[model samples]
Target: MEQSQIQNHNLEKKRRRVLNKPLRLRCSVQNYNWGILGNKSHVARLFSLNSGSHIDPDESYAELWIGTHESGPSFVDDQFDCLNSLKEWISKNPDVLGDQVLKKWGGELPFLFKVLSIKKALSIQAHPDKELARALHKSQPSLYKDDNHKPELALALTEFEALCGFISLKNWLGGADAEQWLPVNEMDKNHELEAVLESIFSQILLSSKDKICQSLSKLKWRLNLEKKKRQLTDKEKLVLRLEGQYPADAGVIAAFLLNYVKLNRGEALCIGANEPHAYIYGECIECMATSDNVVRAGLTSKHRDIQTLLSMLKRRQGFPEILQGLSLNQYTTRYLPPFEEFEVDRCILPEAASVVFPSVPGPSLLLFISGNGTIGASVPEEQMVEEGDILFLPAYMEFTITSESKELHLYRAGVNSSFFQAY
Candidate 1:
């Protein structure tokens, strides 16, 4: 071959390689008692994936971890080659990520991804903002970091319930019931109480337990009351009983806590950092920034960084609001959050459906939650997909899904300008 022809052929091959190469990743599940992805045990199990523990068959399940975070690197080859810890990988590979992602997030993967199954409530806690996380990590190298900020979104695999954000202060101040005095609501309307709580948190940071008893004393009084018979539902009764057991549970006083949102199979909710939340029950397809930095206040026996958590807690009150309103298209409904880390969409196909995704330059994660279907990519042959199966789609690839059963439900994860703009 002529030298010029050889050079042109080499350049064409390199271009094809760059265009077809994508960073999409899939995670293998670990085990847990509730074995589903949403249990407390599952949280530990999920961490085990990174910790390199044996997958406990007695109590374990698995989940895929996608995104550019460094804590848990995805297995890139048969021998499990780890990427440059997640942070370092992004720094070293700017040419691969390009200017779009780098401009918005400095070449770091802006989000974490996971599939969680919850059999119980997570901790009743919140997350520190980026500034606070950095400061805490600096003062005590053991406790915090810039990447510990956890803003999460969960789409239900089964019905799901979680306490998210704070209820509006107006909701608490409107009533003067025994429930209102609960610790979670003590600062509901009174700016003094908020200030006092804040002060106590700062003091606790210095290891002073001076006001701990006083805070718990007032909280216990409100929690010891007998169940009210004034027309409260069964769930309300159970919450009050829990308050009785742990009067210090600020979750009890938040009437918003009494609000049990029933998310059907495909619904979703986004919980931001420093937003007090607890997943009650049921299974969910959860995705978040890939960090396990949780500061708990109550509801579980996990480590509780009381002072740090209190400092991070947003004192504002009201029922937790769902972020990124749900948008419905002909065959899909999307829950778009204000953050760029993750975006989820649920597609319901009756009989058969065809979707032509737009050409975008980012990887995508797709899960077939229910029914059966065939997914066709650039290749002429179609791949059969079923409930619980997941597919990773590379950038700039167009795909179509056709249902073979009565109904096919699917979830898609991708990046769009809308997510970046919201942030």
Candidate 2:
């Protein structure tokens, strides 16, 4: 055979090998100590698989990381090397590494997976849009901004409560009654708070510290009085106090804030960037595009950037009615966002349900949070995966999962539609 033909044959063979190699995704779980704020012990334990004395019964077991970003790169083997380090491997052996993955995805994986167990509410926060993130990162390269839009989905591992997006201004403001005697009642009918608080939020934007202080003052008074009298119910008092501290927080205005959502075992919530939100309680399997640039406004004592966060906030008022918006298959419920870089889905397989593989061609990560199941992928035939086990399926690979005990609950993370189209 001619030299060119021989080289082409060699290239094709190498491509097969690289594509066939399975990437072992990384898992991170944080644990929380009693009364300790910002305690990510569950995340730490899940990522490290450390079962120390601090492990709580309510803590999350694992958070799977499948992307090539540097925050927490997935391991390719037990050796524990980052997937980003594989760039040299790809560059040196381009023939083995598919040209498409290299050219479009830049030799890096695209999505990140996580499972968060929270005993308390996460900070009310928002993420920057792509342009803002890029600009921020450019100005402060040392900071964590990476110019990626992080649209995330969280599936409840247990009963979970989260403040997602904005409640309709009408619903929020309408709930505020003049006779209610709340601080908000002090405002005149013609005040911006009264008008903008009830309509679509786009009509006005909160621009001054005075406006924020005024709203906050009202919330504080109500909360303090409620605490002293103990007249409000337990849930009511918690939110009332939170609202009092951060009255400008749109999440506090959500009706969901007043009520707790009991996600039995398989329910989920999807949150997009700049949509004001907060995770109130319960354990959840979370998945998102590989970025961690958060601009927190309030709700927790973490970092607060009221101005920057408010600027990034998508102030359009209306509670997202997403309970029934997802696309549901027999065993899976897919959360599809407007962006295509990431998609999160919940798969609840019955004991007798056929364990099928995902159809997506890009990298995929499966975190088995519950049930005794057999997973077939890079391993021989079928390996038993338990509640804490996490499995990684590389591109174009197939796998089967069968539950041997009770129903198996799993979260699957994969590249969104945009990744494939772009490639």
Q: What is the C-alpha lDDT of each candidate?
A: 0.57, 0.57
- Each model's TM-score? 0.70, 0.72
Weakest 10 consecutive residues of candidate 2 by summed lDDT? 198-207
Q: After superposing candidate 1, which stretches have Cα over 4 Å from the reference? A: 1-25, 30-64, 68-72, 76-98, 139-148, 173-235, 240-262, 323-328, 379-381, 419-423
The TM-score of predicted model 2 comes to 0.72
**Candidate 1 on 297-317: residue-level lDDT in tens?**
665555667767755777654
Which parts of model 2 have CA positions greater than 4 angstroms off?
1-21, 29-66, 79-103, 176-195, 198-235, 240-264, 323-329, 378-380, 417-423
Worst 10 residues of 1 by lDDT: 75-84
Highest-scoring model, TM-score: 2
For the record, the alpha-carbon RMSD of candidate 1 to the native fold, in angstroms, is: 6.2
lDDT of 2 by residue, 218-267 (tens): 65576567668666644455566556554565444332322234455566
